[model samples]
Target: MNKKGWWLMLLIAICGIQTVRAQGETPTDAKATPETLSLYKNLLKLQHEGMMFGHQDDLAYGIGWVYEEGRSDVKDACGDYPAVYGWELGHLELGDAYSLDSVHFDKIQGWIKTVYERGGVNTISWHLRNPLTGETSWDTSSKEVVRSILPGGEKHALFLTYLDRLADFLNQLKAEDGSFIPVLFRPFHEHTGSWFWWGKDLCTVDEYKALWRFIVDYLQKEKSIHHVLYTYSTDRFETEAEYFERYPGDDVVDILAFDLYDRGAGYSEALKYCASVVTAEAKKRSKIAAVSETGGPIAQNTEWWTKTVLPSLRPYDLSYVLVWRNPWQPASHGAFAPYKNSPDSEDFVRFYNDRKTLFQKEVSKLKLYE
Candidate 1:
C-alpha cells in the first residue's frame, strides 16, 4: 500500500476509538442490556445539549386529580410533558398492592409502560420500610439497622427476600416487542441526611457501601436482571468530599446525582454550587450527572422557575432535574411543579421556553434507547 493510504487508515482507527470513548463509561453492570447501554450514551450526549425536565408521579395523580387519562400538572402548566418521569417503590418489599403514597403497584406498571412507549425516560426510587423495626423509612430510631441487613447479620436472610420482591418487579418491565425498558434505579438515596435508616448517622461508611454493592450484585448477578442504570444521590453537601463520603465505588454506580430543595434565601447559590461539583465529578469519571430530586412550594415565589431555578441550573452540564410530586388535595402545600392557572404557572412557561431546557416534545426526538 502507498504511504498516504497507510496514514489514512491509522487516522480512521484513532477516530473510531475516540468516538466510542465519547459515549461515556459502560454501566456498572457488565451484563447490562443493549438498550440500557444506549440510554447511557445518549444521556451523556444530552449533557452538552440541555438539561431535561422531570416530574415525580406526573401521570399517576396531580393536584385535584387522580387516574385521569392524558393529564399531567406539568403539561397543564407549561403545555408539554416533562422529559423524564419519576416513580416510587416504597412498599414493594412488603408485598403490598400499593406504594407508600397510595398509588397502586399495578397502576405504576401501566404508567411506566406508557412513558416508555412515548419515548420518555423513567427513574425509580425506593423508600422501603426499615426491616428491623417494621416502621417507615423515616423511623430511624436505631443506628444498628444498616448492620442488621448486611451479610451474616440477624436480618440478612430477610433482606434477601426483600431483594427478591424488588427483582421480580424490575424483571417484568417489558415493552410491546418484549424488550426490557431501561430504568434509572436509585436505591438508598439521600444518605448524606439522617432522615432514613441508611443515613450517614445511622451507619458506618463501610456498611453503607456494602449495602449498595450487595443490592447491585444481587440484582444483576443472582437475579439476572440487567436493564437498569444505577444512580447514586445525596441530599445536600457543601463540598465534593462530603458528597462522596458514603458513595459506593464507580463500579456499582452509573449516575452521580444530588437532591436539594428550595428552602430559603440561599437556595439559588447552594444549588449552583452543588450542580458544579456533581458535573465536575461526573466529567472526571466519565459518568452522567443530574439533579435527581428538587423543587419546593411554587406558590410562595411567583418567579421561582425563571429567576431562581433556571439561573441556578443553566450553568451545569447535568442531564436532568426532577421536581417532586403534586398531591391530589387542593389544600396540600406539597405541590412542587405548578398546576394549571397557579400563581407560578406563567413563570414556569417561560422556563419551559428557555433553550437550555428540554421537555417531552424535545427529548422524544433524541431516541435515547436506540
Candidate 2:
C-alpha cells in the first residue's frame, strides 16, 4: 500500500504541474492572488474578441472639467467609459497628496476601486522624478541615473523609499469585500526613447534589465504586493529585436506592450507592423500584448480614429489600446482623445461602435476577475 500509493501521488503531482505549464496558467508573480490569476486568464482570452479601449486620467478630469464625479471625455463623446482605465503615479514616490497631474491620491484610489468593482481593468504607469537629479522623469541629464538607483548604487536606499510609497498606495487598493484590486503595474515605460532617465541611451542594456528585475523583485517579494501584474513597454520600435532588446525576462514580465503616437504619414504602417510583431511575440510567450499608450491630436485628420487607429490595430490580438488624457487646458498636447462635439468626436464614436473594439459595456460582461 505504501509503495504504490506514494508512486501514484508523485505521478499525479507531476502531471498537474505539466498541465499548468502546458496551459500557460502561471503568472509572472508566482504568488499572484486568485483574483489576479483570474484577471490574467481573462485578459488573455479577451485578445481573441477585441482590444479594450483605455483612456488615461479618464475619471480624474477631462476637457473643461476638474474632479467632477463620474465624468469622462470618452464617455461624453461615445456614451461609454473606456474598458481600461489608466492612472499615473508620478508624484506618489515623493509622498505628494496629488499625482504629478494634480489628481489627488484619494480620488485615484476611489476611481480604481470603482473600475474594479464594475469589472473593468485598471493600469497604472509611473513617471516618478529622476532620483539622481530630483528632476522630472524626462530629465536625462545624467547617464548614471539608472545605475545610481540600482541595487548597490548611491541612491538605492532612496529608490527603496520611493518604492515603499508606491507599494503603500497599491496595497491599499482594496474592494469593500477586502480583496485586493488587481492592476497592471507598468513602471519605467517608454524606455526605448531617450527622453526618460531610464531610456535606452541613458542606461546599458544589462543595467536596464537589472533595474526592471530589481523593481519587480522588491515590489512582489520584499514588499509582499501580489495584486499587480508587471508590464514591459517601449516607446517605439521597428523590429522585434528592438522591442525585446532590454526585456527583463519572461518570468518577470506579464505583458508585452509599446507606446506609439501619430508621428505623420508613417504612423499607420508603424502601428500595423509593431502590433503584428508584439502580438506574435506575446503569443509565442503566452503573455498579454497591448498598445499601452497612443493617440495624438486629430485636428489635422478628423477621421483619424476610424481610418488610422482602428484599421491599424484591428488585425492584432491585443488586450487593449489606450489614448492619453484630455486635460482641461485647451492647448495642452495632452489631449489625445476627442472631447464632446470636437471635430473627431464622430469618428471616435465610429471607432467605439466597431465590433473590433471593446468599451465598458462590452468588457463589463467578461467577468475578468471572477
Candidate 3:
C-alpha cells in the first residue's frame, strides 16, 4: 500500500525476470519459428509477471457463446474474454468441415485474427480423423493406421493432401492490419498416453518423432505456412524422463506443454505434481510451458475456481492453463468457464479478479502483440 512496499515488489519482479533470462538454454520464449518472435519474447516476459488463463472454444462457443448461434458466457459474466482461446482443427481436416461444428471456417478465421490483433493468444489443437479408417480420432481399432500415414506408407500422399488443406486454412488467418496471425499450433497432443492413433503403444518412439518432424517441416518448408508456433504436448507424466520419452527433439518444438485432466487421480495433488514437471522442463529447455488442457466437474465444487485450480498453479509460472470447453447441452458438467447464473459463476468472477491470473481484461494493456 505504501511507496516503499511498491518499490520492493517492483524489485522482486525485476529480479524474477532477470533470473529466468539469465538461466537460458536456447533463449526461446516458446517459438516454433522466427515468425513468432514477438509472441515468444512476450511470453518470456510474462513468466516474470503473472500466468495467463485460457478457455477452449471461448470464442466459437461457451455456455453462452454458441457456434453461429448464441452469446458469450465470459463477456456476460466478466465483461471481457479469455487471455488465450483454444480451438480445434478436426472438422477442417475432414473436408466438408461443417459436419461437426456450426461454427464455419470463415468465422473461425475472423475470430482468430480478432484475438491476435487484440493482443490475445490463440492455441489450436488437432483431433484429425484416422486417415486410414475414415474414423474419428478416438477410434484406435485399426493398429495399422499410424504406419499407413507415415512417409513410406500407402496413405502418406493422402495425409499430405490433408496437410495441404490445413495449410490453406491457416494461411487465411491475417489481421485487418495485414500481419499474419501467429498461432500456437499444437498437434498430436497427449501422445505420452495411449488413447489416440498417434499415442505411445500405437507408434514406436522413433516413428512418433519422425511424424512430428515431418509435420512441422512439411507445413513450414513445403507449404510456406509460417504463421505458426509448434507446441509439443503430452498427457500427464510422472518423471522427467517419462516426459521427454517421445519428444520430437528441441529443434521442432517451441512451447513445451502437456495436458492434465484430473479424472479422480487425487485431484489437486496430481495436478501440482504434473505442473512441476512441465514448468521445470520448459525452463530447462528455455521454452514457455502451459497446461494445454485441463478441467473437471466445477459445478459441484463452488470454490473450485479460486481454491483448487489457482492453488495447483501457484508453484509454476505457466504461460496459460486452458480448461476444456463448456458444451451447450443441458446435461453437461464439464464447462470450464462458468456461465451467467451457473453454480460456479460467482467463484469464477473471483478467479477473474485475482492479480495472479491474467484474463483478456488484463491482457488488453500488456501489448503482447508489439
Candidate 4:
C-alpha cells in the first residue's frame, strides 16, 4: 500500500467505531513472508491479549525472577487467564550464559525451552554502555569476564560487540537447524527517548542507524539467525512522523512495538496517542504492533487502567499488552513500578477478570500456536 492509501485506511480505522469489523480483505491466499505470516498469526491470537502480563526486573525483578522459575505466583495470578508470560533479559547478560557448565547451561536452556513450549513470549532487552568513553562491562561478572569472554569496541563497535556475543549465545541455544524456540527478541528498544546510553537523544540518527543495520545484517547473513524475530520499539514519540521516522524499515524489523507507563496521569491521552501511532505504523508497514510493556502503579490507576487502557488496546493489531509489575507504589511510575505504596494487589486481578472474555475471543480467533 502507498503512503496515501495507508493514511486513508488509517482514517477509516480510527473514525470507524465498529472495531469488531475486520478491515477490508487483503489477499489471504497470496504467499506472505515468514515475518508477515508470523505477525498475522500472532494478531489473530491478540484477541487473547490479556494472556501476556508484563514484568520488569529493573523495578521488580523479584516477581519475574520467581515466576520464570515456575513459582506458583505466576499460575495464581494468571490461572484464569491464558497469558504470554513476558520477561526481559539484560544486554550484557545476553553474552553471559545463565549457566557456565554444560549441565547448568542445560538447566537454563531447559527453562527457556519450556517457556516457549508453553507458548510463552520472551523479549530480551539489553543496556549498552559506550566503550569509547571507557564504558561497557558485564554486570553479572567481573571485568575480566567481559574483557576475555565478551566482545568489546569503541563507538558503534560497542553495540556490535554486544550483538555479536549475543548472536553466538543464541546459536548455541538454538536447535540444530538454527531455528530459535519462538520468542520475541527486542533489541535497541526505547530509542526515541534518551534515558539509555543508546537512545537517539544521546546518539545521532546516523549512528543509531549504523548500529541497527550492523546488528540486523550480522544476524541474518553472517550468523544466519533466521528464527529470531527482531522488533524495533520506541517510546511514545511526540509526533506521528517522529514515530514513523525512527522505523528502520521492514528489512531490519519483524515486529513493531512500544512501551508506555502511566501513574494515573494522562492515562486516556497516552492510550490515544499510542492507538494512533501503532495503527498508522501497522498499516503502513504491513506489520504487527504491540503495547509490548505497560502498567500503572497498582494503586494509582487501578480503575482507569483496567477499564480504559486495557480495553482500548484491543481494537488495534495489539498482540501483547503486558502489566509492568505485580505490586504497587508511588515511586513505581518511572519504568516498571507505578508507585512505592501497594494499594491494590487485586488491581491486576481486576484487569485479568474484566478482560478475560475479550482475551479468550481474540485467542480463539487467532489460533496463535499453529
Candidate 5:
C-alpha cells in the first residue's frame, strides 16, 4: 500500500473503535476528561516530552542587536508571530555584540512583557560565549554583572552571577496573580553539537549534570523562582545515543525539545530522525516534545512539507512545531537570491489546516482540569 493508504489504515486502527460512544452519548463533548487532563499535566511536567513549540532566534537578534536604537523593525518582525502560535520563545545572543545595559534589558523585558500582555507567551535564552567575555580573569566569586554569558569554567561562580540578575528581573515581572506561565528557560541547549563553545569539548557528563543541578537549585531555592520550566534541548545529533547522553536529568529539566532543519536536506529523513530521536525520547520520558525550529532554503520544494512533512508528523503525540524565520527567508519562494521558504508552502498551509482540524478532533477527547 501507498503512504496515504498506510496512514488511513493506521488511523482506523487507533481511533475507529475508540471514537464511538455508547448509546445516549451526545455531541458537544469536551476535548478531554478531567482525569486525563490531570494525567496530561503530570506527564507534561516532564517538559522534554511535549509538543513541538515555535522558535525565534531571528526575533532575538532583531530585538537585541541594535537595541540601542529603538528597534521598530525588530518589534514589527516579532509581531508577525502572535497570530499563529500565541507564544514564542526568543533566543537572545548575549555576546560582545550587545551589552546587558538598561537599554538592552528594558527593551527585551518590554518586548516580552508586551507579548505576554497581548495573551501570548514570551520567553528567552542566551548562548554562553567562548573564551569568557572580557576576562580570562574570571570572577572567582559571584559578583554583580550587567549580564553574564560565560563559556564554561568556574561555571557555578559565573552562572550564579547571571542567575541572580535573571531571577531579580523575573521577579519584577510577575503578574498580579503572582504566577508566570510558560517561562521556557533553557541554558546549555544543543551541547551535543560542536558549534557551541561549551559543546562536547567544554565538559564531561558529570560536569554537565553538576552544572544543571546547581543552576536549578539556585533558581528555585535562593530566588523563589518556581514559574520557569527549564528545557533540555539539543541539535539533532549524529545518533540517538548522542542525543540521549546530553540529557541533564529529570530533576534539572522540565522540557525536552529539539532543533531540526531541512537545510536543503530531505524532509523524509529529517522527519524520520525526529521520530526516532525526539519522539521516541519524549514517549520514554513522558515529557512534552517540541520541534523547536524548522525551515528550508528558499529553492526547496514546499509540496514535500505540505503533503509529506506536515502530514507525517501529526500522528505522533506532539505538543508543537515552530517554523524558523531567518529574515533571510520568506514564507514562499521568490526571485530573491538564497531565499528561505519551504518549496511547498501552499501545501503546508493546506496541511496545517487539515492537521489543525485533526488536532481539534483529538483534543476534544482530552480531559481538562476544569
Candidate 6:
C-alpha cells in the first residue's frame, strides 16, 4: 500500500491494539509447551518494560574476532553486552558449508549456550539457501524451492534431512546444567521483501502459510524440540494487512516483529509506522513484539543512537531492538553499531546508559532465563 494508506490504517490499528477492549496484557494461552512457559512469561515481562537491546554476533564473533570465538561488539566497545543476542543458521543446515564470507560453519552452538548461561536471550534467523537448486537465498532464479520442500515433492525428503540437521544443532544448545536453552527462532524472514526466494511474489499465500506451519510442526511436535519460541517477522511493512499478508497463524507464532533500517537519509517515518503496526498486532494477539532488526551507519551519523534511532521507539512497549552486526571490515559502507573509538562511540555509551534501554548487565541481573 502507499504511504498515505498505511498511515490511515495505522490509526485504526492503534485504536484496536491499545484500546477498544482488546484482550488483556496477558497472552491468551498460545499453547506453549512446558519447556517454553517460563520463557514466554519472561517475554511478557519484557514487553511491559519495553527495554531490551540485541546485537548480531555480539558474543560469538565479529570483524576483529574473525579467527577468535566468544567475542562481542558491545563488549569491545563498553565492557558490557546486549540483553538479546542474534545469530544466523545459514550454511549450518548443510554441514561443512561456508558463510557468505567463507567462514566455516562452526562456533554458533557454543555461542548460543554461552548467551544462555549468561542469562541473556538468544534469537536466531535463517538465511537458508535454496533446497531446490542449492543456490543462495536471494538466488530467485527458480520458483520451485518452496513447492519442492512441501510434502510429496522432489526435494521434500532432502528438506526434511536438512531440518533434521538443524534440529540436531538446536537440540545441542544447552546450559552447563544440561537444561535445554530456549531461543527465539525466526524463519523465512523478510517475506515482504522480494530479494529472497520466499518473497511474496514467488509463492501463493496458502503455500507460504503451509510451509511455515509445517516447519513449526516438524520441529516442535515431530522433533520434540520445545525450547523454541517461533516468531513471525517482516521488513518495512506499512499496514496491518501487509504485516499479516503471509502470517501462517497465531497458533504457530509466539512473537510478532518487523525489521527496519535506515536505507536512506531518514527512516524514522517508516520505523514509527512499522513499530506501530507491530506493537498493535502483538498486543491484539496477546503476543510479544520487537524490532527484530534495525541499524544504520552510526559512525557516520554521530547522533544516530539517541537522536534518530531511540526517538522513533518512544511510542510503545517493545521487547527489543536488535541492530545488525558491527563489521570490522564491512563489505558495505558503515558499521551498524558503534565500536570503541568509532565516531559514534560517545553517543552509543549514552544510549546504553539511558534507563530506557536495557543492556546485558541490566537484563542479566534479572535472571529472566533462570
RMSD for all candidates, in order, please: 6.8, 8.8, 3.6, 9.3, 9.9, 7.8
Across residues 39-126, which tens digit of lDDT does each residue of candidate 4 receive? 3455543433333444433222233233234443323443432344444444343355442211133444555555444444545555
Model 4 whole-model lDDT (C-alpha atoms): 0.51
Q: Given candidate 5, what's the lDDT at residue 234?
A: 78
Query: Model 1, 241: alpha-carbon shift in Å?
Result: 0.8
On the 0 to 100 scale, the lDDT of residue 45 in model 5 is: 31
TM-score of each: 0.93, 0.93, 0.90, 0.69, 0.63, 0.88
Best by lDDT: 1
* Candidate 1 vs 6: which has more TM-score: 1
Question: On a 0 to 1 TM-score scale, where does candidate 5 land against the true structure?
Answer: 0.63
lDDT per residue as tens, model 3, 1-370: 6433443474456444442434353322233344367577778667656778888777777663466533567766776688899877787877865525456777777778778777899998888888998888877887777788889998999899889889998888877766678899899999988889888888889889988998988887788876687788888888888889999888788788889875765878878888888788787777888889988777788888888888888778798888887877664356777777889888888887776677775676666655
Candidate lDDT scores, in order, read 0.89, 0.88, 0.77, 0.51, 0.46, 0.77
Choose 2 or 3, whichever is better by lDDT: 2
Q: What TM-score should be assigned to candidate 1?
A: 0.93
TM-score, structure 3 vs. true: 0.90
Scanning candidate 1 in windows of ten residues, the lowest lDDT window is: 10-19
| Residue range 1-370, candidate 2, lDDT tens digits | 5433443453354334321434675588889998999899878866866789999999988878898888889989989999999999999999999999889999999999999988899999999999999999989889999999997899999999999999999999999989999999898999989999999999999999999999899988899999999899998898788999999999999999999999787989999999999999999999999999998658778999998888888889999999988878765485788888988999998888777788887677657887
Rank order by lDDT, top first?
A: 1, 2, 3, 6, 4, 5
Residue 109 accuracy (lDDT) in model 3: 79
